[model samples]
Target: MISKWFDERLELQKFKDKFLNKAFPVHPTFLLGEVALFSFVTLVLSGIFLGLLYEPSTGKISLFGAMVPAAYASVVKIDLLPLGVIVRRIHHWSAMIMIASVIAHLARVYFTSAYRKPREINWLIGLGLLGITLGAAFTGYLLPYSQFSVTATSIAYYISKSVPWVGDWIARLLFAGEFPAHATVPRFFFLHVMVIPAVLVSLVGLHMLVLIKQKHTEPGANRKRKEARGGQRLIGIPVWPEQSYISVSLFFFLLFVVVLMATYIPLNPIETFGPPSPVTPVMRPDWYFLPIYGFLKLIPGDLSISIAGAKIGPEAIGGVFFPGILAFILVAIPFLDRASEAHNYIENPLHRPFMTSAGIAVAAFLFMTTVSGYIDVLHIAPASMAIYVVVVSAAAWVISYLLLRRYGRAVKKGEHVES
Candidate 1:
């Protein structure tokens, strides 16, 4: 019965014709999704092993009760366990690679005009996956309960508190109280272990389904025919032994790298921070989230006023609203870019200027914010960094607009010449 089921699903001839036919060319960029998948696999494997040894209870359990590793010590022991450290190393490294690959894949999709028409839904799914990946990282960071984790959670708490009407409520929902308690660990553990993974898996499956249905978009003139014909057919290779070979090779290479980093650098435990304390000045979140934290600090404390007897702070407007708006804008890019022309980066600037500029602006903003946070931690003036970020962001926007104008003129000139 299993054999019949497998045979019914497998299209051996189609797989052979698609992959074995030397005519079909596979772009190196296609491997990005595979890398992400491999990372997810690594996450699952390491997570399962860690889960077995981990004690999720926040209630005061005796440190002396179990002869085996417990709580914080369990993680440390996992790192020391023959292949345990390697597993974590692979997991951590895979996460970094996964995030990076996802970004790279998005860039490839944008530059190649793959997010057009029928593929827009896939792009949105990709965006959702990106958010989930970041959330997974955030939740995973809290598991070790180290000093960095404590400080990071404090910053996260503050961010949650900035959320207007539901800020405090959201904070309570997340951490379960005023500060780090038994509830905090359990809540984060549940999210990291069960909730977020389930969402990620579902989204990933949707992303794959969309990919299989829509087919991968190609670059240059090769893609023009499909666009001209309304994209009625897919043009790509099969995902079997052919692409699988390359995918598995890349995954193992990355796994080796992850093991190397885990063994060498290891995950740092913030021993100095002691426990969650609001008075602590050295508090900072993981590097990935430093941008938001930096934005929170950059807002002027005096930039608050009473509108209709209700008070508002700059932190609320700049940190929460601005970021949320930007996220919405990013997710809505498929609708924003309405041009149907198929041109690569060099040929079409106006159509994609906003996307390119937005990417640059975000990168610059994050860099500035990260630097600003570092300076703040060192007792230096973070305001200077913030000012620089504002100046640079403004300048980038202006330059992008100018480029768009030039592109528009060029397109018009070409059209006139053809006529």
Candidate 2:
């Protein structure tokens, strides 16, 4: 009766025809986006549970007969609650997995040339999602108000303040004055629990709508052959059974993995770190921020320039300028490699020499920089790390370009080339 009532009111048949019966690509790589979505769902559910028990403040509270920040004390209380540790661990791991999956999904889209033409808007949206995800993670990192978190997050505080003209303003606005201030925890908590999640949810909805509109980009020229023979209809499983089955299975699998990891592996024990202190510990940002940390370490302390009476320092260069340039390049890729017509077929990376080579170089650069982030522990010199990064990235670019060009020539000549 309820179904019939809704069907009559909402035109359920039309909705099913539009979405439920639509074609969905049956590829393993396509699951990356779903994994990210599932992870986000997990985050939201876990976050709500945590938030109900959390105290988002830096105010002092009596904890175990000692004074501690309310935020830190609340975290400790949550840890004592039944299944709270597991829930927190799941939340932490889900964030990590979500970020990783988004990155991998973007990489798959890039290497397969799925960002071509009409899908450019989705590409931009995906990048926006990535930024929002990072922002979420960064804000959440400070909510515990622990020594480690405070110290690590303070690096970000300084980095924000490293901007030339309005650096101080930005830092004051974001961090609520110097790091670990009374208002800092509340500000971060609001962003992490409310603002960022709201934006993330909206963007995710738009992303799915755009995705459904554009349809999935299929791999290789097989779809082209099918299109030529029949009509331009997509060849894939219907969303009703096959795709839904896979999606359901994948979500459960993700949940199982997250639960298993949460049970076994502990993440960021704030109790051990203690509350925010004047004695800052030697700490580092999470792995996602390692590249920026590495870049900051690579630059010399003395590197600075005065521009229009404003002093631009190494922190600004490495933290702000480097990332800004990379983001610009990524955003410009679709525009720079504009297609004459809408492209629904994915191109092999080896066939696109320049794009593939640039990807290789950038990957090399990121990997080296990530390694460089641990130079203090690794006992490596900054100059040596810089030289190594440059040499390896350049060599990777040149070699990959040359090899791909050779392969292209062989394919054009119709020669049998071994992989």
Candidate 3:
């Protein structure tokens, strides 16, 4: 009687029948997202561990009665704790993997044309994730308050201050005052720990949900065949064996990279510019952002506009506003390309070649600009005329190609085809 009552209450037979009949398929490339997920998981775990030992407050505190100096000393304590160094290394390495994996995933999607049709929103979400990743990295760099961090923050300050009307206001909001203040570290700590992570987690969830709903976009030809086959679900292997294998491989690879970087190319602690000082001109941002930094510096000082009794520099418009707009455009690409004939790169080369070439050209230009910035920072004055020539040549080439495409399209339509 008791057994029957329990079975009726729990619906045991239905549960067992459903559980025992589920099928699983193993797909090789599907493991890429798994690797990224693993890295994010590692980041969260390590972050929690670090938070427990970290004092986020900017208030003065003594460590072991030694009068540990504010933000720097707290990080030092994190280093000196048992297995603290390893934990920190793991956190840093996991962050690198997360960024790398996200880039790789996006590249895979682009090359495979997985962003076509019903999956466009997922593409936008992925772009959001990229932006969040960059924001997290930037804020994380400030947490350490080392020489590199200070230099990077100084560069950030200048860029922020270059904004049109609210630039100075934004800079003050970020740093909590002029330059380095007691509130700076705490603000960054709040952003890195709570705000950005929450947003990142939400976006990641949205991306995954959309991906699952749409299913993975197979190669276009394969998709056609599958449709012809009366919608038979393609087999995918279980997450255990296939995904586990790839995840393990990626873990070891990242481990090797972390060890190599930590041992051979340890993160440089900027010693020259002690603390945040405006007198020292030696300052530069992190490498990922150097391209934009160089662009700002390249803008001429004379390009200014007077509006509302305030003078605005071209650096404000071109460097900050233009780049920010470009970023928005990039995120909206899937929506902008409204063609339905074909979506894969090979099939729609004519439609997307300009976009593809433009992307490559922009990457090349940014890389060169970054190198120029580094040269300037190192006291080796870069040739301004040479840089200008390169920039103009690239812009001219892109413009010419676009005009040729426009004329070619008009001519093709003008001449009626014999069909």
Candidate 2, poorest ten consecutive residues by summed lDDT: 410-419
Q: Write the residue-wise lDDT of candidate 2 on 280-320 in tens digits.
A: 76677778888888999999989999999788899999999
Per-residue alpha-carbon lDDT of model 3 for 49-91, expressed as tens digits?
Answer: 9777776554555656654335655677777778676677777
- Model 1's TM-score against the true structure: 0.80
Model 3: residues >4 Å from true position, as ranges? 1-35, 57-68, 177-179, 224-232, 235-241, 248-260, 268-283, 307-310, 314-319, 341-352, 377-419
* Residue clash pairs of candidate 3: 25-236, 25-237, 26-236, 26-237
Q: Which candidate has the highest lDDT of all?
A: 2
Model 2 TM-score is: 0.96
Query: If both were scored by TM-score, which would come out higher, candidate 1 or candidate 3?
Result: 1
lDDT order of candidates, top first: 2, 1, 3
| Lowest lDDT 10-residue stretch of candidate 1 | 341-350
TM-score ranking of the models: 2, 1, 3
Root-mean-square deviation (CA) per prediction: 4.7, 1.9, 6.3
Q: Highest TM-score, which number?
A: 2
Q: Estimate TM-scores for all models.
A: 0.80, 0.96, 0.75
